[model samples]
Target: MLATGHADLVSVFLGSGTLTVAGQSDVDRKATRFDPARTTVNVTDAALRPAPGSPAYDFLGVPAGTPIHVIPQTFQPGVLWAGWNTEAIPRGALAGDSVDITLNQARGPGLVEVYLTGLDGPERVWSSRNPGPRTLRTAVPTHAHANWAFTAPGVYELEFVASATAASGAPLVSAPVRYVIVVGPLAAAPTRTTLDVAETVGGLRLTGRVSGGPAHLDGGVPTGWMEFHRHYADRDDVVDHVAVDGGSAVLPVPDEPDALGYTARFVPAFHDLVAPSESPTVANPRAPPGAIVVGVRDRYTAGDTITATALVTPAQPDHTISWWTRKGSTTTPRGTTGVLTITATTDLDGAELGYDLIDTKGNAVASARAVPLRVSPAPPPTSTSPTTGPTVGPSTTTTSGPGAPPTTTTEPCVATEVTRTVRPGEVEVVTDGHFDYGPVIEGGTLTARVKDDRQGTPTWRDPSGYVFHLTDTARTTPPAGSGYDFLGSGPVWTIPLTQRPGIPWIGWNTQHPSVLGAVTGDVTMTLESVNGPGKLAVYGQDPFGGVGDRYFGTVEGFPRSTAIPAGRSGVHVHGVWAFTAPGSYSVTFAFTTTANGRPLTTKSTLAFHIGPGDPAAARPASTVVDQVGRTPSGQECALGTRGLADTGASGDVLFGLIVAATLLIPLGLLLTNVATLAAARRRR
Candidate 1:
């Protein structure tokens, strides 16, 4: 597996009542959150060859002037800085408004210590040299950096957990999360692998060879199986494993029409002594051109001006470029240009900017995917004027008849929420990208979100991105005993339980990394509402056409919910989603789960263009706005003063710490998690 050669900065934040860890390097413009079990954080030899001799630094338990690896509390030019923050935990959300961080275990070659330099002196938070569990308590909305000291160069695994009492009188605790830190020089020798693919009469043949280090003490060739991964539109799937024979492996796979690309990785038998290697992606004949690139800003505020541009590989100057806006099967042509410039208004929020490459005949040959826009509200105005006089507030009084209780009307708080819309061509056409609901830590709140998983990478997309076009291929009559009487004995458009050509394969997978790692209970996705030309129903069926789990339906007296088993890594489910008539269907769904002892629920509206009707005319289930935050509660009620500049979570210190996929998803991406794939190839 790949080790984080140099994480210039690492931030551990409170996510969904759990510790969310992320790291950034000089080479990485944005910090990325990774699964500690699957990643290794590397502390290079540049840390500290000679430890600080100051008496104040002696608490590190290492001899002064001796060799030590130190991730400093303050930023150093070439070394990494590890820190913690509680900014994602809102004020008054926890009992006593504080969170407890505990270092449950620290295993390393030598002593391991973490401390902070306070105004009084050095305050030690963790010391493996000492005995009991070391814990630190900090108020919510806190962010601080600390010094990490290691006595010897080796691999260290630090286990951490966060705990608190929720304001609702429940105990909240995080799962034990592990962080692997490798203090270099590394012990293992690296290796490399190369792959080649050829077409045979039977199918496609793959050959791979491993070389580099004679990683064994006996100078023996590496012996292990080679794992082959199939690349789809957005993710990679393991297809086959071939054991190495004479340092090389060959595997033959049946020719599949939809196959896009292939990649291979070498798994060393002496895994600990020799690092595994991976081969670059080998594109198939059907693989789309990778040279179509798009560029745009990450985010914008309302009323701000922005520009989005696209670049073609061969410089298609003669090709006509047309800009378009898409929302639920509706496409609005803007103009013909390679670049689009416009004012970012609130209405444009959640919308997308895209370009179509049209041939001389006016037919679109290639299209750049729609990139979603994130537009936040402008900062509230500053109040610094001196008041001429103290303003008096008006007193309210309630009056009612003597026999009746006071009759009063209380105005319910109305918070605006947003769930963006997406039409055809907005997202690349894909056969599979497991869809599910997972927790997302954003804006200081842990909220459930509809996520799209491409391989092991999970991304939170707006409801609009969940749209699917139900074409004639999905048209079929409901089978008897299918428990789908809601379709009224008429032909319906259905996304099948099995994969079919020219249509999307929609499914829910609770095994997504985020959901499987953080959640401890069953997840329920319920249909809250639906708006369309006709009714809708969702249910699972066996290959024999026997119906199984009935999830949701718009017909009266039909089930409207389905539950996924808790913490099960195999809960990948696909079902038939049937629609009664042709038109755009806006289906509202809510995913609920109890995580960290707190009950959480997130809602979103998915758009479905059923048949040949004008899908653009279909209205959304509910309106979406940007004057509101994307938190689970979507609460906008607030009255507060602007605080001084500090390293809060919202600042660059922690803001980039939240894990998210890039807004611009390249079409026909042929890539894999080479590091993860290598580790996964190890023999059992």
Candidate 2:
């Protein structure tokens, strides 16, 4: 039996979602092994780390359906998977059960099926891309001539063949295929798996592999899908989350769901997509046989409206959703912490809570997910008064109107993702060496702050720098600047036009720039040169507005025709004015190419600002008359009196002096007078 035996048992491993099958064939009858030079599989390059056709091939034991994931290297007919290799199963056969399946040298698309008859049902089966087109479905398959399967009793059989029967409208055909024994379960259960998670910008991605028991979640189970209403209440009311497309599932976490204090259980069975009047069979009463502990590690205060989200990417659409609350049997079977608000605010004191998230399609129960949330009291009021809290503040503690609950339109705080703003002078400019500018562009520097809302900076060159700055509410005027050619005498120069279509204009001998850059194209270079004593003036193509900076010109010479694209927005006009009453001035001739039958405008504002040595003589007589003025200082008023005559000859005054002197001299002789007076008294 051992000598006659051709098929045998091998190693077995577990996988989460898909399967693979590979083979080779030969036309030579004597060759023992199939030649890959002629054989074509869905893949080309072998396995990663271990190259194909080497000792690494046998050591790694490459199974079918594993994705060949490598960068740059081409993997034709992309299957989108990242890995390439599958696990194994075994069958009982005498000794040499090593049977090698034969495949063709060229690659062909086909269908694959795998089945284990006894213990349960088929393990996995799959097909290629959409069916090829027959003038109808370009996405449909073109060839379906082969079919394959794997069955090795206690061992597994893997088949890979292009079948003719797998066509959409085609009939089925018979072929020799094998099936593995399903009667006996594995001697030891596969190890359990765990999930590791982290928070990201908008969501979180959970990834990990199974450990003790292989990680498997089947939404295609025929029966026995759990529907949990409430544990310790009615098992019929409970329902499990479904896996719609493939093994991977997606769930959009609601922004307003309660957070913290929750657990999750994943029931491994199939359930209905539509709501059913009757409940399906429950494979495991405690569906999801596995448990994940969850709780809120973050908290918010009362009146705190929070927004949390989880972005899920599914192999396909149509996943399920369910919600949970805290109060429940088994404690672990709890749902979201309803005591906490969707925008949870703490009561008086700060506390932490969690929300129980449930997926309701296949067998996702309350025990499937956990969340951590913090319930913090609103920031304490600086005023310690009991009624000073935010909840009782002016914008809060409002009454509901007409059977409606009050709405909250405010949130606590979050970081804004705005780019920092630079000043206007930061506009990009040419630098000597080092790179300097906003990080948006590399190796470039800015000289002025940009108008950030997107208006680009205007450019200018010498001799044509008729730059425009807003003069008032409606007009723009020029200041002392560089856009002018040397003119022996004329009025201040205005912008020039290369061409002005629809309107005839005069041409001056020196008007056309002798050395303006090569004509951009066939252009009508408009020259606004004053003649017969006037200084600056001419007609242009600009209509209803000033010529913009995009100076347009044509290469064709005069009497030549050029196709003017279209538009009047660019500079294509000419103007002139005398400087008051000038001695010398300039004449600017702007260039413009035909624009929509008008003129194309380039900012090359060629102008003649030069004037005579004294332009004061150029002022109009009326302007000079307006300057007439009176003297700056007013006449002063004088106050004076006629001189008075001196009374030097006052006789009364001289006589009085003479008499007093005589009297005083006698008085000085008063002692003599007193002696005389005493003698006169004695005589009396």
Candidate 3:
């Protein structure tokens, strides 16, 4: 008696009503016997597995000829499990026991329900409701399979429970299980990347390329982006992202010192397709040495101080340079790194000074050749002693020779002799004679005289304000009537004298035959009107002007007695004179002024000769005067008729000879007749 497809037997009974053996013994007595048995089947836990090489199992009490099926399933250790199902054998059941087993549980598809936690945002990688559970069963045997359809790449913790009921009406519930799923490649990062450091003006540039990634849609090029990071001593700087064009990227490194560390990474845009990678640590290299320039003076004098300096490009910190001389024999440590100072001595003349750049270990990194020093000798000292002498004074002398009458001669002025030395770039002014020589011109009785019988000191002022004094020996007395009375004047000033352009001297003669009275021309001189506003007056002492009287000439439109106003500074003024007689004339020029309330006065004398006179009286013009030609005394003069007849001894001799000749002619006739009578008598 099987119940319900022979899965379980409710009861089994056997009876023959008091057994046949007992009926033979006691037929009369009524006898009865009964026997009963019960059987049941149950389902046990179901296990999901791989096709082969999976965990194997043995069946106990499974009846022979029972239908058992082996099914294929997909299995992922942390994701899902699917395989064949089995029923539990009854306890104490023999291998041949009468029991039935059936695998009637619905064999649907296998699925994994995944919930992602601990993420920055919400992300759903897989869900069963969208496409329903995947079929875990397959017809093939001993084959590997996978269903990797992850929407995003990240870590996910999965909570899943599998539930099913066996054909025997038994229910089975699997404990809640957890699985950690890393959906994408293990670590999709940059790889085989390189960091090349290049130096720039103010910093460094780092460039690199990454190769590993999904082939780009356009070609086999890598499609992704890269990030660069520079690690400094104190901090890390992250550069901007750059697209991986042609599988390469470049970035500018932050301005920092050399030997700094940095990193580069290649990250794929499709996180699921390619794994990211990072490059090994790379460092920047040191920069090359910069240009060095040394500055030193070329020449100096002995006992002078010398200084030198060196300028280095791209000035580095803690860098030092040493100063040396003569192949490092003479070393002088500089107070500063690049500056040097030394006292120049005679021994150091024509020597070389050198320099070298050194590192912390005192090793020379760069060097410069030595520069030569030229030392000259110091100059000599100058003398400042004052000159002593009476430069100008009047002198009178009387001399008498044998057979000659004594005669007295007077000179208006005579100068003393003195010597001086002048140095370069310097001018010396020397004054002589009495300082109180007053009234340059005076008159007494028939003779006009100079006060104190001495001329004032002669001074010259150059354009550069250098003042010089004329030597007494430079003075000269002029011949009579040249209209120049002063001595120690003329071009002797040494002051730069230039003629005024376009202004000709009116009534003055610059042509040849410059004899004083021969051509009846005017004597002219130019005066530089630089010494500020002043008065210039010309006083003339002539024989025609009687005692205590004199003639005054006009200068620059101003009369001799009146002061001539000085023109603008640097202009030239002309002083002109016209004399009538051929004799020596004394002319005095007095210049007076006040500068800033300081009184000043300058007096000079000019002397000139008029005609060719007695050679004994021929005196050269004043050295200060610019004479155009010979004086009147030096010219040739013709004799007139009256002067020829007055030739004393020669005229008497000619007249006496003529009278003797006239008487001799008559006497010769008378004597000739007598001689003829004598001759006739001598012949008889």
Candidate 4:
């Protein structure tokens, strides 16, 4: 016999209840409250049940009421169900309308008893009465129906008889059902029930598993009447949906949020018997408040380390908790509450930490706060401190206190959408997760690409923290195509190919895609197998459009081979765009006569205009730089404005451009004298 009843109800916030899943959904969350492992009943044993005061607490640490069936009179004096009755029901059946009893079976029959108990207090009670012993004939010819019942509500106990005998009437133990009669205005309509959720560090799991004892009630246990739903206060995207598995519930650890919380929605909550509100407003807050306090014991300089105590507490200890540092969204906490020492590193521009609590039933509550994890600027080098008062000297150890170990909280780089401030001649970049740099550059296109073919396309990872772009020419519109172009993005596809077999270069020539990837392959070997043994192969794509199996050549500097032996590794190939005169250039790779398949070829890709490398050889003898921008010294950069430098020597200077000023005057004077002398001779 099992105990069945209701507990405190809970108000839920559905939108905030959603979570990110990295595993199976049918998984059960092991509750720390009661062990389901010990509840196994040996149906064959005459005496069966949990020993009194045993670790198993009334079906998951719950308080249940009355026995559903009992056996007062037994024919035999032998074995009973191998267990004791823990109910508070009366042992005898002399009761009137105030007591009720029942033994029901639509499909099968089991021995049962009915009785009652008196209350000691809200937490304790007493019962030792019976309605007499009776035998439940399981092997009887007509074992069709054994439905039993009694009249009224209080002063009675209910029990299920086991190992009952036909002769001498052996006796068994019993448990009482606690039934309180309601007569006040605040009394509920009997349809309302409290939903108290458990808080956890890992998250919640609500399976909608609805179970109750007295499985066969006056009209069979009302497992069907009960239903479960979610209430997401922050996530209002959807109103409701059907929960699964016998009203058993499952909630889980949510994914990192985009903001503080999701939109709100009111989904139906679950309950066996719905009780009315005691008060008109709302039930006693089923959930407790959560809090986290942060305080510093010492102040550390910028780029240094410091720490503070993180104290977290809740009204009741029903929820789980965890700590989290800021990322792009509100996330899980760092090892949930204790002392969290944060460092004063330069990366802590906008750091945050949060705590999450979960209930045994998988309900959750959370709280978080944001703070600046900034590094204090370093102290000035020289002490202006009254030199007159005392002789001053430079000291590196500037801080004083009871020395403590350094503390550092996680400090991530700016988020993907972050924008770094820029300078005229400098470009901005993210050095790491902790640094934003200002670097000087010339006219060079700096392109970058990052990939992890194994993990696939990831939204959480992007170049959000570092941004590089050119500044427009303040107010002057260009005469046309004279500036620069920036290309920054590419497709990072996550192709799960560990078990993927090599597809035919062309689909038609091969067998209908033989499933041989998991088999032995030349290079795709299995070194480990936690999840299906699979790996990513780093193979270069053919530059041409046609597909074919071909022999790719070896590195030019390495020993050449027509076909690589099994398990052979690949070598690196470096390419350069030559600065010689612009002409059609063709390069080739050789695998000797031993080469087997088709020639490894790629079409012409990279194309650009190339002028002279020397100033004198440049087609134009002179190109002027007038509105040249320069640093405060007005000195031209050695690399020049466009990263183009002027030839260093006289021979390298562009032709026809006058260099020495002394050689110019004589030539001008000679031309002027010739004109004057010609005019005088003509006049004579």
Candidate 5:
């Protein structure tokens, strides 16, 4: 989403070192960069007027004295002042201290011209009026405006590509960025459409959704027809036109083994001033039928922890994963996750462990895949048989096999292989899922868990086993703004406000069932601490896609608190989650809500593995651990504590406590240890 409005001067600017260009909007005396594609620059009908009678203006080809939509070089109050600038390109950053902005393409209702009207007459920098040069050279550290004259009124896409040679002799070229300009009256509400593909029983199902438009347009449910395009090695072919219903359209296509890719274009039905939008091309890869590949051991020792994982072919995170065990005709539910950890016992020797994969719409994709277990009794301890009555001496039991000395067998402490390591393309991560209180206390108390809504039936995931992977797709330079200055000059990894392939789409929600009911008033979320290689920042954007809220930033300060309204339905929000450097980061967030005149709070550490790294190896700096009895309630979390202390407990015992803590961490009362427990109690 981009910020929309008619500003004095929204310049097409480029970053010198990074070479990423953006629209710099100077609105309300503040400068901010917005995604030009999503931004709507409106040239009101009032901008329409007679062209200058000066002979020099004839170069515009609009015919002098004829009426046209012209945004003058000088500031216009009600009109949009659109122009290009190189002010962002610092000195000595480029080889020639300049860059060339080229007009790759222009499509609209009529001719377009960008020129400077000075003493030299009308100097044409770029014009669709003439079939001549389309490139304009501009020096670094330069700021200039030009007269923008449009022949007709409608939507116009000005494709701009900037290229220059870096100081290091590297060629710097930016991808063609289209600037969407709306000339004259608001004919259409700008819209953004997204396309997604999923494997179906027939072949492939292509789904497209038309979203985003000016809220004032009263553009009710967008009625549209989605044009599906299939790409070949040489050309793209229009496959079909499916009418969009309820803002979305779905087309079931037979698997094309020879097709290169697929894309969809949304053309809004006439009468609706919704702009047309296109989706990125989706690559076609030969994939087999969806099936769950269960990973487990054929045999296990009794009194052991069994860790089993299921990998679904053509991985779909939206699919519901259910682990089950069967002994005879009855099947018991084990868990719901890619990884299932359970204790092994002699009673479960003949039981079969398996899983079922269900689609998002409550449909079974695959089921009944299982493997029987063979659990044997654990080895008994060795004992010494004393001959006759032993004197007043303590004897050690020494058992020898053959001529070798006796060896003692010790059980493993920690179950190190429980959680599965998720990497890019392995699993679908709802990066922005709500770290919220569950609807009801399934265990003993209200705790916070990751509400995984990828599938129809949302599943609660243990934070310890859940990891948000940030792929290289999120690598980008921070735009110019005090809100983003904390990211520094280097390229940072960002989990964007919108979903990007491979990278997790991170955000938070206060949509828990208890939000409006039990959680009265607003929910206070605080960034307790961030432990990682570099600083982390969380921010949101306004309606126009400009920075809105700077909720929490490590570089700015620590323990910053923000309040989110928990209205009738609660709020679902997604923001830009940026990491200064690539590494594992544990961000702790505390959520407090008032229920029935009583205050309840829960804290969870969000584990983010930015860039390349084994997500499994990225452990939360602080973990919730059981603080009490031998048998953990498994629904508790440490309150008022940042980390768990090593209490000289065995690794196995600690691991169990960690698992137990995760099970009920969302709505349970947890304690790091006796000390932290006392501290929490005192605070209460």
Candidate 6:
């Protein structure tokens, strides 16, 4: 057994069985470990491509809404790869775990480069390059796309690439992809326009024009449907729509309110060639009111009061109406009320009265026609006379008519004559009094009265150089060398004179009491012309009332020569007759001249009174004569006075001689001294 084949056989059989089983199991394990399935490296296609006709992909004239697909044709297992990648990666890795995309224009010529920027923020994703490629990276997957823009409008070939890293730590990239991008040309926008508004008679005219558009285009003015608006304070109203003519339109203003205050606006028609526009607002104007009427009278009398009235319709509360009158150089305010009363004075005889209407602030609205005024003259007073007689007997007269009762009236006193007995060369004192002639009107008669006082001495010098002296006591003879004759005097004392507008004539004193109430003399006056170029005449009317006579005295009549030589002087005897009537008496003196065989005459008068000299006595009760003709009444009188007195040489002659002697003595002494001086010189 020890070296024998039994142990060997048993051991060998067991070992051999065990070895066979172990070998089979070992084979099976090795087969399971070495299986044929395993992971490999692969990638998706990525590049930049153009959408030819899509609207979204339309760059200028390119197709729109097309996808950009970049396929890497040159992509091999170990070469450069380019495309867009939309996968996430770990932080701070090659693509920062975000979409990684790039564009390259290195192989493209004469093409606009592509650029990409952040859509939401200002991040430069990719820059445009003419001969290079630009890249973009993100750390996380995002839906935000970059803003892709082109530098110019043209076709472009861009190289694109996308990159990522594998889970097994191997680098992966897309192939360099060529992208064909088609760009198109650009277009322009429409232009702007304007409108205007103006005023016209019927309505407001709207005008407008279009500018800055295509030169040859007919869209210069808005041509389609348009609207007009009238804007009020409360609301805006659409007036109407109308056709525009050469860039303008018109709309009538509505006749609703009397005063329409509104603004007008024009809405231009909308078209593709012009922009929308409206006009500036324009306003309306104001109008005026109505007219007035005035009323007045036509005729008036001096000192009469008249009224004028103004009538106005639709009266304004603050308006004022005034009446006025304009005479020669004066403007007088009649009244401020509508109705005015004016007192007509003599100055306003032909004045014009007018009226004016004014507003509250003194703006004149209207003026009335001026009316002319007519005024008549004033009237005169009544006249009557008194009776006078002697105390012994009643001076009465009886009148009997056919159908009247017997009537008796007292008459004036008569006079008797008595001569004064006087010794030769005896001077007698005679008392003569004064008379007054009252105020005189330019064209009226004169009246007189007896002045109870002494009269002032009068020195009368006629036009031809004749002088007379009459005093209170006596009348003086004409001076020794004077060209006058001595005229007589009588009991009648003073005579007052005045001038009135009538025929040119004079009245001389005619009648007187010869011997101081003893008797009466004839009422006459003697006129002597000493020297004159004219003929002098004495006119007298007797107290019994008749036509007077013109008397021309001769030189042989001594104190009564009427027709004197051309260069000489004369005098007239005035008082010698008794006055029988108690009324006004007039004596006239006339001077007549002849030139070229034509008679030219001038005259003056002396009017006197015999009784009470009242102004009413001069005014006639019946018909009287005036400048025009004989009128039925007399004018109102304005009376005045002039007086005559007697101035004589009673005591003045001696005093005058003494003055002459004194002056001559001194003159003689001066002459003697002069002669003595001449003699002394001769002797030397």
Estimate TM-scores for all models. Answer: 0.32, 0.15, 0.20, 0.15, 0.32, 0.15
Per-model tally of clashing residue pairs: 1, 153, 31, 127, 16, 59
Give the alpha carbon lDDT tens digit for every residue of 157-246 in model 4.
Answer: 222212212122332222212221111111111322223334355443222333332322322222233232322222212212334234
Task: Give one digit per residue, the lDDT tens place, for model 5 in 233-316.
Answer: 333478899998878889899987656567778887533348777775565555344443233555889988887766554567
| Model 2 alpha-carbon drift over 4 Å, by segment | 1-302, 305-343, 346-350, 354-372, 375-458, 462-684
Q: lDDT of candidate 1 vs native? A: 0.54
lDDT of candidate 2 at residue 229, scale 0 to 100 = 22
Identify the candidate with maximal lDDT: 5
lDDT of candidate 3 over 1-684, digit per residue (tens):
110110101111111211010000000010011111111111111211222121111111123332222111111112221111111112112122112111111111222322211101112222433332212211100011112222233333333332333334444333333222333233333346666667788777777676754222214344578888654333345666788887788787556653245567777654543566666545545423342323344678887887765544345456677776662366644344566778877767767776677778888776654677777887677874211111111111111111222222221111111122322223211121111111110111011111110111111111111121222222223334433333112311110011111111111111111011011212223332312112223332111121111124423443344332211101111122233333333344443433223343445433322333331122222221110111123321111101112111121111100000000111111100000000001100
Q: How many backbone clashes can be found in candidate 5?
A: 16
- Winner of 1 and 4 under TM-score: 1
RMSD of each: 32.1, 44.4, 66.9, 41.3, 29.4, 68.8
Error of 3 at 637 (Å): 22
lDDT of each: 0.54, 0.20, 0.29, 0.20, 0.55, 0.28
Q: State, as a TM-score between 0 and 1, how close model 4 is to the true structure.
A: 0.15
TM-score of 2: 0.15
